[model samples]
Target: MNQQFEHDDDIEPASKSQLKRESEELQALGEKLIPLDRKQLESLNLPDKLFEALLEAKRLKAHGAIARHKQFIGKLMRQVDPAPIHALLDKLAGVSDTHNAWLHGLERQRDRLLNDPKALEALIGEHPDLDVQQLRQLIRNAQKEKASLGTPKPLPMKAYRELFKLLKQFNPEPPIPGVLRSDDDDFDADE
Candidate 1:
């Protein structure tokens, strides 16, 4: 009975030591965020052009695509970082007060665009190519193209969407204003 008890005590200590070692290994693994290899990274459902962008991030201050690529890398890092990822998942957790400030600014700009005649006039003055007459003429041309029979025609949907997207990106709304409580009916304001 004494021999059996001694053997049982030895087994318990060995098992505890093994558990501690395994726990430490897991903690070490969690701490190291390894950069995935090309084939392994490709397995992730990222945009097809992402690898190219990442390669560009290796270079400094490459304008346009490079800036965009750097932004992409930031996004990728945020995604991979357990801390940021958790904060993003939890609405109450890691909040960007700066982003909130920017949103508020955007809302103010949007209100200015809507209510201030001078601002609207300025935009029209700057982008004279986006005149209402020109818009109407383009719509008419698109309609004519669509209506034409025989051999399917390509809609200038690409050009129209690209133009509108660029305009919206350029003239983004400011974040919420203290005075302007948004209503469900106001789509542009809500946006």
Candidate 2:
């Protein structure tokens, strides 16, 4: 019994450095919450006092005031469960592997459209809701920009960016719970 007790005592508690690291993480999470719109912030279900403190922090323009408020928010965070908050933030920030893969798929489609003229027809066929004329014009502009670039000069990506925005707007919605997505889905094959 004595030897067992001594063995248990040999294990050290978390170090001050570890505790400081945890505190800093909490502060960083609090700072992220500050930039979120009021509706999104409320969705996190933060403690009432912490939410008010965050709103106050958002209103503070002075550096010292903002710093102090941030510290207060961090302190309040210690009193609440942070796991759910972290999950919500991760979802909102598109930090999940699945969300990142979806974004990458969008990039691939954009690249395909830029490189292949037939891709425009295929995309239009897939998404009939998209304005065919507008897409054609954008593709023409993007191809022209790509061809006109001088040696060592980068192509202006304005049309490319616009095409991405349009694709996202018309991208098929991910199937909800209990409804499995079919492989035949037009956009986001990984979904």
Candidate 3:
């Protein structure tokens, strides 16, 4: 008994039910990754085998094949750190407070760009990587669209949306607002 206890001390063993729940959660995460565009998938920096698996999953249309592929992807996920993946997915889904704030900021900035000519200069200064010419064209088009809105035959609101999308692509990630999650109240074993 003493020898057996010595082998498993200092760590709480997980129950079978707990393990199953974790597996299901990971499988769900993998399923979410399947629908992501190539750019988003590449940003995850997944391992080559896992990346190929995801691409293959995307191509699969049969229900049974997709289900089995998700299980395989879940197996692959077990080998990778899921924290960053979770963070990126949450940000993309706009579920987190910071991501939602970032989107609102983009909307405000788009308004600023429309109302103030100098806003474009300031934004370009902040994000040097932006395609300045395309941005300028989009801004010009949005401005024209807004100006024509009151006219009898106004152009449809295409550029306005395009401007917002462009701004979103170039905007920086939002800063955390220090709101703690309710789950933070969970007991910490380290303590």
Candidate 4:
């Protein structure tokens, strides 16, 4: 009896219901994996068969086909341990860390604009919806304040803070679902 199991032979085989629950959990895990990019999937170090199956699953789109393929993934999952895979997924999804790296990137951009005149054009190119005049003013103000102070250290001036706030509003990352203050769908009226 113990010979049938890999981890522990003393433990009895799981009941049918418990087995079914595990299968469903693995299927759910596969569903999450489907949305991840190829690079992320490759980083998992999963068994080759499972990796190929996942790639196929991602390539599939038809509803019935996807349903059947997901079942196949669940079967494949049974042959593998899920703990390490799940830990990697959590790290990629920013579940384990504060995920503040994007914020730091934004700050770097802000500083770049302050230092280089050409940076404004690049920023505008990336965010076409930006109010160029307002941003130019903020940059000018921030620059003046920086030049006025003899200290080499950066200061938290009003314009510098305002620029960051404005930049934050146009963050490229999709906002978390259900985070809106109102379910208004951003309805706006034209003049």
Best by TM-score: 3
Consecutive 10-residue window with the lowest summed lDDT within model 4: 182-191
Residue pairs with backbone atoms closer than 3 Å in model 3 (clashes)? none
- TM-score comparison, 2 vs 3, better candidate: 3
Q: Could you report the Cα RMSD, in angstroms, for every candidate shown?
A: 16.6, 7.8, 10.2, 13.5
Q: Which candidate tops lDDT?
A: 3
> What is the lDDT for 156 in model 4?
57
Tell me the TM-score of model 1: 0.26
TM-scores, all candidates, are 0.26, 0.59, 0.61, 0.47
- Give a tens-digit lDDT track for model 1, residues 102-121: 44565554445434657556
Candidate 3 residues 68-146, lDDT tens each?
A: 9999999888887787677767765656666677668888999899889899899888888889898888888998999
- Models sorted by lDDT, best on top: 3, 2, 4, 1
lDDT of 1 at 94: 22
- Which pairs of residues collide in candidate 2? none
Which scores higher on lDDT, 1 or 3?
3
Which residues of candidate 2, in runs, are more than 4 Å off?
Answer: 1-24, 35-45, 60-68, 79-100, 151-156, 172-191
The C-alpha lDDT values of all candidates are 0.43, 0.73, 0.76, 0.72
lDDT of 2 by residue, 1-191 (tens): 89999999999999999999999888888888888667666656667999898888889999988898898898888877777666555555667565566678888887899888788889888888888889888888877777768757777878877877778677744432222343332323232
> RMSD of candidate 3 to the true fold?
10.2
- Tens digit of lDDT per residue, candidate 4, span 1-191? 66667557577879999989988999888877877666666656667898899899888879999999999888888887777667556545556332245466678888999999899999899889899999999999999777767877656588987887777667643333222222232211100
